[model samples]
Target: MYKSPLALMVSLSTLAQYAAAAGFIDDSQLTLSLRNNHFTTDNRESRGKIGNAAYTGQNKEWGQAFVLSYASGYTLGVVGFGIDALGQLGVRLDGGGKAGKAGVSRTPGQLFPLESDNSAVDDYAKLGLTGKARFAKSELRVGTLQPKLPVLLSNDGRLLPQTYEGYQLTSKDIKNLTLVGGLIEHAVGRSSTNDTGLAVNGGTRQSNKFTYAGGDWAVTPALTAQYYYGKLEDYYVQHFVGLTHVLPIANDQSLKTDLRYFRTSADGANDTAAGRAEGYAGAGYASTTGKIDSRVWSAAFTYTLGSHTLMVGQQQLSGGSGFYQVAQNSLPNEGAGPGSYYLLTDRQVSSFIRAGERTRFAQYSYDFAGLGVPGLSASMIYLKGDEIRTANGPDQHEWERDIALDYVVQGGPLKGVTFSVRQASLRSGAVSDLDQTRLLVNYKLRLL
Candidate 1:
């Protein structure tokens, strides 16, 4: 069933009225957050060789966002019910007339709305509503959602976070275990003000159904395991398994290991040749077009001592096909936007998830608190990927190096203010070469 905005508003209004009259105000909460963002990218894809929009060249933009949210407590009853509302406004600080062209912000109207000629509009705003019902240790939510799971993770690389329209159920009735199931229909991109149907990468056909089920189990005090299954109707089906363990070596030293695996296969339209011709195919590097068959696995290890941490990891992808993930850009109605994957290689500049690819990564992170400088920290990362399978041939490779710094006000008039900076350099034989930087400031306030 489809509903107009007015109909949805009326329904929300009725729910709010009922909840208020039932004396649920005692547990309600409201908050407002402000964020300022400055992003720039310089892509060196060689003149006339820029096949992907992400490598279009020097693109830069500045924007600010305000997020206002309210959550109402459940009503007094055997089965409690509640409501949540979220509203956001984004405004452009500086951008116009082809100053840059890299991420969504470079598209003029992406961060803000667009004018008649595709120039950036001054500002744009969107509102969302969610209703919740709970019984015992189980809760059901229907409406806007931001989910962080092995199957699907929301993107927040830009000024605002991506959101999905769906119905989800979460239960923690069993000790040390969590169960989650959901059905997603539509998604609002991190940059766009509109909603688009879901589809796999490179699939122009849109499907409103995305089903998923998953669970997380804490096997022991230092070990955890996870399993999940997800399917995008007519696109692909995927299964994931994950394990994490930590071993304490000494009072101040420990080793943590993280492992992940994924298996994917074509489904419905994507499983047939004719269906692929009709735009139901997978994206990224692959030997065959539109065929979704792949296995990917990765393992990471970290050693921590005092304020210093060191990590290394590697990922491998089978040559049958590239990894698959739901993205709105692949939908026929959206702007062919870029989406992210769940992998260690999904970094600031690129994702090393190509067919037959193998990636190795390392990182060093330090906390300033050990040096008497609280609320400050920094990290550096380097990743290399090789043995990619492409239509032309194989043996392609890419690498990226990144540095990040973050600081927060510990105590003062602006106690909770934060500032962060990130810089990255990427070199790729198959994709494109580029340098990028991002600066962000954030503050939050209690409203009620």
Candidate 2:
């Protein structure tokens, strides 16, 4: 059952698609997509306050999103150019009652700054435009972007989704090598759909710019290396290095290995008194003068045989406080929750990289395409985090298990659409919370 006008709009969109296709509608580059998400969670840890709390009841939520896009290709010429526009809208279909509470602030809303008045907001919308140029193996884009990088990943867990306004340069000038560099000055939160300032967690509200540079190099047909650097104004500086190798074992069999490392420290205004005076805060063992340093390392390996793949990984963190980054002013990204960092030391459901923590993880995946179903797959992952030591002592441990199923329409009018469902269970003896479930559906259309 649907509760908001936006839900009705999504349904109507699907119907309109079928109707247009049936009526042989032509000459217009129009595309309609709908995504429905249902989330249910049980928080057994806290109900009242921060420290003192009881078990909270189960919560249920339902949300729907609609995206309508239009684009026209450039006319024939030596230099070709085109314009593209995107329209996004979201609505709360159910939940918002006592059973449904706010879990993540990434969801879109119009009436309320963060949460709606006792209930989820009825609807929200945003418009995006892009100017692009291409030549040979290199291309440049200026305007809004949703980049999935180590430092500035676009969070799409909620409705409208967060977007960055910036300029990016990408090139594949060399074989099997990709280079990227960008400067971003502003961000639009998931809810508001308006470009605003930036800030880090526990820091004073200020406009902080983000800049990053990175490259991936292929040494061989089976080996690759990656390196990147990122900085958030008055926050922390991060450097990342990674290597991946694929080893051939036999006919149609291979072993894949991944090695990653990160080094982080204080930077810019965070290193000065004026910046600290402006309300900047540091993570992990901040001294009287407020300085911190951190290191993280991780390695993972996967073995593939027929339709099954098995993976195992280990990660460790040491030195100053946990990893740090640009804090969220209004909402947090999917993996950037409290006590979490953008490092190899970040374990699912728990950050293994505290003052001193180690984590181990294993995962298994199956492709039904090998069984004749082309677009169905399943995966399960488990992670255990322990050996966390601080001024208090080493007496904390946590673990999480996740299962996921995914499928996409391979043929027919709904071809190219995708659907996914995920479930997660987490337990901890350390300072954390309880279990949660997330269901997501995604549909993409190419209008060019």
Candidate 3:
């Protein structure tokens, strides 16, 4: 029998609430959001007969999201209980072959998913519910969960964010420290209602069970540290440590520093020859010869003064191969897909920070608010990644420059609305690609 756990939880919670002597529905909130985006990309190769000038194309996407959330407070009991529900809907508009079937909404269709004939479906929807219990500063939630830890982050980059069907335990009993642990078995992709297994980018087609535990500690008012351990069944084990601090500088100025380190190695089933024979090749780089281990470190510092902030960072990779993660089913960005927001030390360009690779980056930003314009901002960032070591050739290098502008309406009819434009130029001596650009506009509306 195919039964939906989310549906069952919501039903059971509602029934239980009716049985209670007195129940209070704490809050019921609804939100409606619409986002329209026009994306264009042009790829130009510097060498090779692979085509000198890649064609230029554009895609227009329209997304509508509706969320209805309900939370109930405890009913005068020692153990507090509650229920939460979320419903989502997405639709495609103005995106087809003529406008450049550059996205999932056209071409093979399946804008969201394919029908029996393998054509794109124009609309999709999903419902999720979570039952929770809280006591003191600890809470346990089962069913739909959106975890935001470094090891297990929910991707919310698309029309509808991905969600996990799992259970999570969070505790903040200790002052200045927060603890989180979870077991996730499945994930629903941004464009799909079906829950699929987990995979890393450029990895084999298989899903591994994910288990993780971590904690963050605020060592001081201006300093914080974090450590986490993550495991994917039949694969590698990952450990991460991070530290952040704010150093006071001149008058009304400060320098913020962030440092992160990750060490990944094979374990359990991945270490056994029989396990290797069964396709448990670990993470990072996997070849017919053997698997590779990886260690990466990054440090960044930002100086804030007046309306401007300047940032510089460097990253180094040492190991048999590059950093590794679970296989991914879609594009790569800041947290998940392409065009990710590099947080100072993110060496995403060329995946430099590959084995034996070193990368350096610098960024500058100015907020017009201090100069009387509250909603306007501009930023420019440049990153140079080099020393990429691979068996194919000698060390290679690549560089990219990005410029962005943003504005948000502070008041009036469109208050809280935001607009953003981003442009990038990339050059690589090792790779043939030259440049790319992305523009995005987003807005949100709250209905309660």
Q: What is the C-alpha lDDT profile of model 2 across 1-448, one tens digit per residue?
A: 1344465455545544653554423433667777787776666673212354556566666778777765444433454444445567766676554433444332322221234344455565666665666566666777777777766677565555667777888889778889988877766666454565555655554554778889889999899999989887777788989899999998868899999888877777777777767666564444323444678888999999988999999988776565555545523322222212454434334455555567889999999999999999999988887766544544466777888899988999989778888887777655546676777888876542
Estimate the TM-score of every prediction. Answer: 0.91, 0.80, 0.82
Tens-digit lDDT track for model 3 on 182-272? Answer: 8877777766677666654443434547888999999999999999888876666888899999999878699999998888776665657
Supply the global lDDT for candidate 2.
0.66
Q: 404 in model 3: Cα distance from truth in Å?
A: 2.2
What's the residue-level lDDT of 414 in candidate 2?
Answer: 83
User: Could you give the candidate ranking by TM-score, starting with the highest?
Assistant: 1, 3, 2
The candidate 3 region of ten consecutive residues with least summed lDDT is 333-342
- Checking candidate 2 for backbone clashes, the offending pairs are 200-327, 201-327, 284-321
Which predicted model would earn the best lDDT? 1
Q: Mind giving the per-residue lDDT tens digits that candidate 1 earns over 157-220?
A: 8877778999999999999999999999998888777788888778888889999999999999
- Locate the minimum summed-lDDT window of 10 residues in model 2: 330-339
Quality of model 1 by C-alpha lDDT: 0.82
Those runs of model 1 whose alpha carbons end farther than 4 Å from true positions after fitting are 1-22, 47-57, 98-110, 113-116, 336-339
